[model samples]
Target: MGIIKLTNIRVYAYHGCLVEEGKIGSDYRVDVSVKANLQPSAGTDNLKDTVDYVHINRIVKEEMAIRSKLLEHVSKRILDRIFNEIPIAEEATVEVSKINPPIGGNVEMVTIEMTLHRHNHKQQSEL
Candidate 1:
């Protein structure tokens, strides 16, 4: 098994609980860790044999572009999209961080992380 980690992917997107947040937008950071079998790709050095992180990153970017009301929703969407796109991934950990969240205090960021296993995800899809 091999892990593909994409960290601190910065994106400017409109996502928040408040109306102003969606209007002005804020910076967000996404981190994704994908676990998969790398034996085939390792031996063949073929892109198709492993998870294409470039495409994964692109999917993240595209999903981030869509405005959402909550971080949890966005994070789940990302995980779902990743699982749908990368069938070979055995498990995925996704984190979505909202930079400097709009609270009445000083906060660096508010983050939500979720992990999904392919088998369970597949079962969910089947139902």
Candidate 2:
């Protein structure tokens, strides 16, 4: 097993409970990490044999574009799409951060993180 991580993906999005946040938007940083079998791709040097980082980036961008009240909601959506779209991804974790959040006080950011395993999803589906 191996991990592929895409870090500090910057995006401008409107995701917050505040009305002004929806209208003006804010800067967001997204990080995604996926684990999969890398032996095949490592040996063959073929893109198809591994979890594609480009696809993961696209998923993050697409999901972040949608408006949501909380970072947890967006984080879950990102994880769900990673498992559903990338079959080779055995597990994934996503971190969504809102830079300079409006929660008062001197805070750098507010972040929401979520992790999902493919097996867990399958088990849930079977129930």
Candidate 3:
């Protein structure tokens, strides 16, 4: 088992609990960690054997484009997409940070992080 990390992907998106935030939008930074069997891809150097990071990035971007009321929802969407679309991924962690959040005070950002295991997620949901 090996880990693939993609960090600090910046995106401008409209996602917030507040109405103004959704209207104006804000900058967001996303980080994703994927755990999988990377040995085959490492040896064969084939894109098909491993998770395509470019495809993951595209997923993140696509999810960010949609409006959400909370960062937690955004992160969940990203994690779900990664696990469902990337067959090689056994687990995934996603972090979504809203830069300069509108908290009416001095705050740099707020981030939501979620981790999901393929087997546990399905079982937990069914219960």
Candidate with the greatest TM-score versus the true structure? 1
What local distance difference test score does each model get? 0.92, 0.93, 0.92
How much is 45 displaced in model 3, in angstroms? 0.9
Clashing pairs in 2: none
Give TM per candidate: 0.96, 0.95, 0.95
Q: State residue 75's C-alpha deviation in candidate 2, in Å.
A: 0.7
Scanning candidate 2 in windows of ten residues, the lowest lDDT window is 118-127
Q: What's the residue-level lDDT of 31 in candidate 2? A: 92
* Native RMSD of candidate 3 (Å): 1.2
What does the lDDT come to for candidate 1?
Answer: 0.92
The residue-by-residue lDDT of candidate 3 on 26-127, one tens digit each, is 999999999999999999999999988999999999999999998898898898888778988999999999998888899898889999998976786689
Per-residue accuracy of model 2 over 27-106 as CA lDDT, tens digit each: 99999999999999999999999999999999999999999999999998898888898889999999999999988788
* Candidate 1 segments exceeding 4 Å error: none
Q: Model 2: runs farther than 4 Å from truth?
A: 125-127
**Regions of model 3 farther than 4 Å from truth:** 124-127
